[model samples]
Target: MAKLSPKNLHCELVVTVDEKINPHIMRDRNTGQIYADDDYLYRLKLRSEKRVIECDGLRYLDHSLTVDEEGNQELVLRGSCPSGERTEVEVVHRFSIPVRGRYIEERITIVNCGKDRYYLEDMRFGFRRGLCPAYEPGQLADDISRFRLVAVPYRKVGISQDKGSPSPGARPSVKRQEYTMEDMIEGKFSNVDWRNDETVVGQDLVDRYRLRSEGWAWTDGRCGLLIVKYNDEMIEYSLVERNGYSRRECLVFGGAGFALYREPRPASVLEPQTKVSFGPTRYIFFDGGWKKAFYLFRDFMAEKGHGLPDGYNPPVNWNVLYDIGWYHSDREKLFKHYNLEALHREARKARDLGCELLYLDPGWEVCEGTTLWDEERLGRVEDLVRTLKEEFGLELGYRTIGRVYRDEFPNEWYIQRSKEKGQYIRPIGSDGKPIGFWEPCTECREWWEEKLRRILGITGEGVKFMMFDEFDWRGPCFNPSHGHPVPSTPEGHVRAVYRLIEEVRRRCPEVLV
Candidate 1:
């Protein structure tokens, strides 16, 4: 067949695998690892086989018209099997146009001479944007473009509900569990595998995102009837699910093609065969515009297909934070020269730019005889919070440093109680060890709870958020009387601090707990 280019195309081919051969035995030529046994084995195998073409009829083209192997015009298939029961399959694929745009098509086929039946599982076909990087160590950082799987079969397992339990005559009711693939395919599946690297990994990083695994399963099954409309352009892949009583389906897409083979347990069974047809379909292509593509995909699916499944809520959008202010005094230097008025102005600017919360760092209270709000230097906390909400439409939050308030106020009660309980007091230097100062009464959970309630009541009045900080630190205390048994490990201390946070959340759910 003549090599296909972006300019001229339309082709088809047929591939068949017998029933007795194990499809899982096929190893990837590039990695030398079995490609058919991985999580999405069949799909990977179809991607690797690059020989078949899809068109109106099969016709061999001039060899000179084809692209050189190194020029990206070659369709090639390389395979390996360790058990030596089946013939290795090879198919060479070549593309004419160097760049893929609006309209495109691909074709592929497999020849099986093995003695076993091969079950056809899935097929993937599409014109991938950007260069596909060779599967080598540490190559992800250099690859700019990615191979995205445009379509695939959906595999899913469903659970059934149970009937009345513990009833003697209730017929031992049971429900059925089922598994199946959806016939439809759409969306972009990337070829950047993150399972290989850890440091520059793609999975957890927020900015680099991909279609989730669960989303792929929902659109499996609607074979030939599916159409991928890119903007106004549409590309069609043909599908043939049941070729005959003895053969399975052949799924073809884009300018690329795919064939499936089911592996057999023993080497003696006859291979199964099937023929499938797709296309006469159209592709609506857009130029260098991804936003348009996304909108078109969503609209086409909504109008002609099903939308996202039930219970599906898009991931929450969160403000990406660099470094939160008000946590460390060092960061306060960013606005140190600014007084209350200047700080309020800067905060208002941040709010206008979509900042959801304003964080206040520690040093809010004057550590004196009456640990009162430091009105002289920091201005009125309540007034600032009110201005943030009414004037700037922003939320307020503060850092909580678990230290004794040395001034006169409701906090003074906590100081007095700490003394009465003999929890701990500042000790004069003896050795070089850290000294224990004011400590909460660990034995009296009520004391902690009451103190927290009082503190929350005062702070939560005007604040919309609270950043509890400095709760994890070492302190000397083996006082059995006050109930704290001196944390034995760092993990224990961490857990204790987390427990306090949980308590705060349980008490105030509306406060962004």
Candidate 2:
């Protein structure tokens, strides 16, 4: 048995290697509580085989403690997967214990060593099994009923537009769910990927479990593990949950192991001598309950440059759409209520309410996705800024989006969802006509430049805030001329969006986006 107890962490980790190596023990040193033991660390399936193989089944080759690029000391375990008479794959599991941070970083690498190509069906990592549920009570641990899964949803939930507006005091709340062993088994740890489901792309609804990059926390009210993944690929892999067994149940974390069909859409293949990596999944351990865990996570993110600037106090914006009503793209109501006169009245209300800014929703755009300021209906952007500041003492801001209510671009600039024989010009519906609306591909260089230029034009006209909404990727584009891949990938799309934001900040440093 080899043990590692980092001085900064409150937990102890260990691995046992006699015949096979298993990095499989986590113990909270505070109360002498043991969380996992002799657990299977990873599970991966080969395309040709029906049997899912685990890390424990691999023959142990060697183990060592090495320093990684980030200067953290890591425990590295190497193993080889065997076929009938030969070694086919090499697996390496790494656990990095940060000397200054209260967390462990886990990553797995699978290198194809066989002569033939290998198509991976699935891959999952973490403490693969345990003697009992993590929430189960023992002399050294808290009761099972006291355990809770605390998640701060990545998007708005519990508030629905169709059901009518919530009261003025209503706000989005955190989801704190209590679960039994059965509930954990039923839900497992499957992640929700919005890009895979096209039907729900533009639909409005409530969802609490959207797999966000921010990550989630699981707690027993005394100690907890905060799992965060930095990957922003088009599809999301499951992380953190429990799996059930008749005689033994395991609390799984980091990688869920089950592969979703759409995440690696157009399934990827590992050619011979190729290396595929899963994650640099982080497990941040903390004492106390979920709130403390969240605060710690926030601090961790801040350290990673995701936090707001120091001493930057945000202003309270008064969105008039709540009072005037959400007309969406309805031209009739928009023309009647979204003009300057109506907005002036709303500006007065914002002034009266001590609001610092008057935020426009969807009606300020020439078209919903145009990002062009409707100077004809809303007056010039400069005038709106002047009146709001000089007359009502409020700053000016508006919403910018990705999907267009009307097709305002060349056919090639929009998303190409189909490459059928007759679908060359535009996306052909089942009925053989062009799709009604257009979703601009962020990865399209022309559209990307145009969108950035338009957004900068408005912000340059003294707009203090810009609310980026409705920019979710609907699907991939199949346009070869767009300067992206023939079928645009989620990673490319996300990077384009990030590049857009970065460029905006670079040009308009003072503007809050």
Candidate 3:
């Protein structure tokens, strides 16, 4: 038994052992609020020799406080793997509560001690702590109703819910989806992962309330528990699923576990003799509602260099899409309202309306996703930028997408999904046209280099803003010649996107992406 009593923090974290070391509770000293209860630390699953082994029900070994490289005190808890498995694995849970900080940072380091190559199936780095005691089935307590699970899913980040609205605030991506603890207790959730367009068989059969979110907060207006994980990969966590109507009401981090939506198994592997760390997940105990959690998330992100630059004052953009309308790759309709002359009229309107930038949506390019400026239709890119600035008094900006309106690129450069089966490329659109509208695999070196070159060319012409939109993961790209892993993982897709953005910034640091 041990208590982590950080002097600067308002709460004390208590760890206890009952076969395993459980980070049992975190209690707020000032308000006398019990923020956490019934907390177990971690769970891991591995596959070897066609046999599945679970590293849960861990046996407690010892714990100690040590100074990290940055001089922060970290509480390290050591544990032994269960005696049942033939293979040996060592797991350690490290937690740090920085001085004068409101959050506890946690991570689990797993070291495979055996010789066999182990495939990591599932790893719950942090355990869910119950907010309230167990209640009878179908019964909801008033206190429980006060507690809401607030989550900000990754997809909603940086995107405005309403496209036509004014410039979004700093926390535009912060979605305050408040589902009361009572909601989960009462079993309120969709049968499928419809939110992400994924459906699975017998998913609803288990009454687990699963939600996809980068981080979440369990709050009751006055006090809250915030959990956030910041990783390079475009991955999220599910901390809201409570299994099968049981009264264990804690939100488990690996409750539903990590896997591609609708995939039968995990795509992660742990080679022998390698050490893997699962998190640096922040566990914050704060005062006030779920918004406080969001503020902390923002602050943490800023610390990670994800925030705006010191002097970033983005111009108020007047998007011409509202007036010009999406031409949908129809040359006839596009020329009618989306030509350079029409855009000049819109720029005049933007200048008169006090807008600082005239944002082109979809028609400036020869075709959507080509990233080629239609010099014949819109004149030269540099000339247009000078005109937009000198004549209209507005900076130039445009949107770019990964999906092509037509198949200009080689068929091999496009996305190839296994689900497409024998079909080599995407079929024609429902309109019986070869809009061959599939996203080019960004991981393809040739496509990546070409896209980078095109974007750099546009930015070089004094384009101030470039919005890289619709570059989401369509699925694993199965093209063998692409040089990426066969059935490329979501992480690979995300890294490729990041690489593109980073390279763009490296070349054109002044342009806002």
Candidate 4:
């Protein structure tokens, strides 16, 4: 029954809504424009207590809009709904189309607005405009198949289908994938939950760069929809079907919904007047293929201060760890294969061959992953770096395992200490009981801090680059002493990793992560 229309150099965004404050059409002025969409951009995906909350379904309320000095526009719509006469909740949805960047951001705040509490679950935010109403439901689904859906799952060693990194004008690492609607129906493509080593391939065995991809893209040939779950802890890229453009044909892509690591805890009370911020879910529409859209996203990220410094230059050198088969070691030969003199000689040879740096992968630490270096074998890391520079004029770097080596490192000491403090990763049971065996709980604040200190210590030894191998420690942790949720979630693990990485950057900003 109401609408809001805005125009800019990108395109004109016409937002139409009904009594429920749901946006029906977000038609772009020019379909062929770089940032234009072919149809009503998409509808929002939402749910509470298993009941779908559509824009037209709820009773419409009040709406308003505001524009800043920079020409950024934010539309706020407010409405209220009762849950079968029990809890009454108010919803305030804010859709912001920024003056800059290639994506439009969305955030929804749900408040009880009543004396009682409200619970929302499995809520995913996505877009779904009626897809070619001229076609039948079955036919629409068929049409969606023409536009392939690209799902990017997060992996430490992401098996990229691309050639190189996304440095400047280099060929972007775009992993083009097409998971069918059949895959969504059968639950084959799961992007939210973390997969273990059994399901994950080329993780601990091989070494590769991290893609940080947990998103999806739908593209035909010229234009498409891009919904990326960028750096949000509570969200995951999803493709589950919902009420949308078709009965069953309209496929949803690049949307985010709630993904639990384990059984979710009971919903806490939403006190009256308390506002909950749902998302800033990223949406980008662009001309050409999905690559062009993704590149726009990449550029947006750089504009947001994630890119390198103005004049920073990275040294792309060789790592003798994985190729030479020295990555995984139980110290069978000790340092005989890679001792101080051997590394010195190798550095001399490699330096002469124009290798900018010599990476002392393994066999440098006295114990596997231990900060202590062997005096007799590789000598001190500082001394080795000085020798690598002084003797061979080579740059210095280090690579270490994130986990303590079972065969070589002293695990008993760590285990006994953990046992004494009742702080091991117990993974099951709500009673905070041990689940038999254990892996060092990275979620433990102490353990995380220790790793931070360890990384900074090594970086202070003048390391140019540090490779954190086997870092994605996964599983449910029931140990309450670790100071994480009863069952550690994928999001919790990711947040912990991000925090630790941030801390390292804060302390040692010069060292390459």
- Could you report the Cα RMSD, in angstroms, for every candidate shown? 23.4, 5.6, 5.5, 8.0
Q: What's the CA error at residue 428 for candidate 3, in Å?
A: 7.5
lDDT of 3 by residue, 239-333 (tens): 55654313555545532255334221222566778766654677777889877878877887788889667888998999999988988778788
lDDT of 4 by residue, 1-513 (tens): 566875455544555567455554443334543222222222333344434543323344678889999998888877665234423566676777877644566665666665543445334434554343433443444334456555433222234443335566654343334555444444445332233533112123110111124455656766665666554335433333423333333334333344433111222235555656554556666666767656766765676577778888766565665434553444657655666666766776678788877776776776665545667776667777777778777778777665555433223223222224442332453345533333455677777777677777667777777676655644445566667665555456667777877787777777776
Q: Given candidate 4, what's the lDDT at residue 34?
A: 27
Best by TM-score: 3
Model 2 over residues 1-513: C-alpha lDDT tens digits?
455443334556677765566766666565445555655655656653434333335667788887667766878888875445436777888777876676777777777776777676655556653535445523122333345555533422342433345678876543323344345544532333333233323323212222333466666778776777654443444355555533455556564343333343323456778876764667777788878877877786677788667899767898978877777777788888888898999999988988999989878877788888878788789988998899889999888887777868877787776664223244556557765556788898999999999998999889888877777766667778789876776667778888998898889887788
Query: Where does candidate 3 stray beyond 4 Å?
Result: 1-9, 17-19, 39-41, 67-72, 84-86, 128-135, 138-146, 152-176, 189-208, 243-267, 419-423, 427-436
Return the number of clashes found in candidate 3: 0
Global lDDT of each model? 0.34, 0.66, 0.69, 0.53
Full candidate order by TM-score, most accurate first: 3, 2, 4, 1
Error of 2 at 63 (Å): 2.2
Report how far residue 230 has shifted in candidate 2, in Å. 4.6
Instruction: Give candidate 4's TM-score.
Output: 0.71
Give candidate 4's error at residue 53 in angstroms: 11
State model 1's lDDT. Answer: 0.34
Task: Kindly give the stretch of ten consecutive residues in candidate 4 with the minimal lDDT sum.
Answer: 202-211
**Model 4 backbone overlap count:** 6
Which 10 residues in a row give candidate 2 its minimum summed lDDT? 200-209
